[model samples]
Target: MSQALAHNIIAEADYLATEERASVRHELVGGEMHAMAGASERHNRIAGNIFFHLRAATRSKTCRAFMADMKLRLGQGALFYYPDAMLVCDPTDDHPHYKQAPCFIAEVLSPATAKIDVREKWSSYQTLPGLRYYLLVDAERLWAKCYSTNATGQWFEQELSAEDRLEIDCGDAHITLTLNDIYEDTGLLL
Candidate 1:
């Protein structure tokens, strides 16, 4: 789902201010605009499953779990990214676009966008000051990998497998996950 930026129909700033609530979502990258692709049934299911677990796990905490449709306004240095799922622990979750610093974010990868998720998207998400964990899920393989920021602020990767139950430690709240749970009904190749 990659497309060349159509001739600059609107300036990045103007695009931001206008149609902020438009039905068709567009992402800004170095001023180039690319419309988002519609989700497939598998895509929707994976996102739904993750959010469901996150919501229940964080109910008593200050963190809020959200589905992919929520816009994330990554600040100046990066573009606005709409992750497949996100968790925000910052008290500023009231902001429009869910611009508040999020503690965790996940992207369900499709073959068309896997590189972007593993590279560009991963790089952009890491820039968020308050971010702690980043997870990448492979739709075709049903594989999951996570990156957690260490005490010195550097991020480290952790790989999760079907045999092992995974838990994301988020201070007061922890999100327990198993790869099999997300792909239960997907009938994924792997």
Candidate 2:
């Protein structure tokens, strides 16, 4: 959708509400609140695969893995967003309201939302304090790009392909997996 159209459809006067009745997550951009869309088959598969692996690896620890259903309150303007998969090592995130601390966040791109995922959402997620790595899993390509926060407060990116393995450090937890493990059974785009 065009920026002009988005601005027109979402008016500037709709930001007065403090809360909503239902559980629908609304993303606010440029004073417009855009309702999040549902996930596709490929999105579900990628999320499930990632979550399964992470859960198994971190099963014995206090760290936990959450799927798309859980809500992540990234910021105040952005009330909620459902990530494809997330890993939180902080024990405080176990609260009922929403996960406040996320060590790792992943979003599986789709045709309709690829631009938002890669651009707008990426920028917003990078600003989170508890976030260490933000991963964008490509829908068309058999690759993923991870943005890690360096000590200098700058983001360092690493691209992982079919030939590479992913090793992520989440504070108290460490998890490693190969591309083959994530794309098992399901045919990957590579």
Candidate 3:
């Protein structure tokens, strides 16, 4: 979801410290804090569905799935974002508060954050060398867009509806997700 900038700019360490104790989550962009807003019911369901499938697929594997609370640090700690769902496989990429390497990231798009998710977040996420797949799901409908990198490092975009399935390559394994799975229990028609 889109965020509103908080007060004055603060140091990266200060922001992290504040986040540790603050009840509300915030994203730091270039040392400025942006308070994140709460998500809607449909958005929560979609994100939960993504996390559920990802967690199930990665169970007993080296990779681990994380949901909204985990922070994704980018631009060398100059930026921090909370992705809806993400999969991280690199053991060395771990940090207590944030993760640097995520092979797959999914965001449930709301009207308030669709532009940022498609433009700003997509641009930033593509810069990560470890990132291979980015999925944007529409909260109001059974529609999703996926961008996956091929063996040659070329990114390809695919649009999926209710009948289509999303295939993700996780290096050690490949997982397939259907719109029926993503939109499950959300009351969205396929």
Candidate 4:
């Protein structure tokens, strides 16, 4: 969604190595390093709100929620990205630098990233194993797009508007959140 570092293809090893030393965050997709643009205040706040809700929902379980700083690796693709927020219930997903077993991922869309997020990233995330849900949040409006898979692993999408509550059913752990939960203090509603 952000700008690619260059037209050149960067090896996975180099991308990971360079990201550690770089000040800003970057994503590696199709062997290309794309420098992530800074999130707007609304974007950060919305992500924070989701993290808070998810963290609290999974507090009693083995699950944990992480915000933007944590990197996520796309299994088998050698692509890595920073989701706005993610929820992981697998204790075995304890990687030193990145996670691979996130059951849920949320991306708060900015004008610059919306197209890529909806098309490219959406296609990629759908192929992940055991990924229960993917959420796309609107930074400038009261809307959220939900892509969720069923028990049979078929994907379906839903759109929530205004104060709609999204129900996330991950069997043992369930989370229900409304627009007010994410847009509360972000001032995006105004």
Q: Give the TM-score of candidate 1.
A: 0.86
Minimal lDDT window, size 10, model 2: 10-19
Assess each prediction's global lDDT (C-alpha) against the native: 0.78, 0.73, 0.90, 0.86
Q: How many backbone clashes does every candidate have? A: 0, 0, 0, 0
List ranges where model 3 is wrong by over 4 Å. Answer: 1-7
| RMSD to the hidden true structure, all candidates | 4.1, 4.5, 4.2, 4.1
TM-score of 2: 0.79
Residues 1-190, candidate 2: write the lDDT tens digits. 6554334443322432422443665555655566777777767788788888778877888888998767676566344567888898998777564576888888888898889889887887877887888888866557778888866778889888777777888866787766666655557745
lDDT digits (tens) for residues 1-190 of candidate 1: 9987656655656767654767887777766667888877888888888888889988888888888777677756236777898888777667765455888888999888889999998888877888888888887776889898877998888888768676777647788888877676777733
Cα lDDT for residue 51, candidate 2: 89
What lDDT does model 3 reach?
0.90
For residue 68, what is the lDDT in candidate 1?
A: 79
Among the numbered candidates, top lDDT falls to: 3
When summed lDDT is taken over every stretch of 10 residues in candidate 4, the lowest stretch is 163-172
Per-residue CA lDDT of model 3 for 40-90, tens digit only, reads 999999999999988888888889899999999999888999999999999
* Number of residue pairs clashing in candidate 4, backbone atoms closer than 3 angstroms, sequence gap of 3 or more or interchain: 0
Report the Cα lDDT for candidate 4. Answer: 0.86
TM-score of each: 0.86, 0.79, 0.93, 0.90
**Model 4, 1-190: lDDT tens per residue?**
7975657778777887898899989999988888899988889899999999998898778887889988888855378989999888888989867888889999999999999889988888887797899999999888888998888988898898775779986636789988888788987652
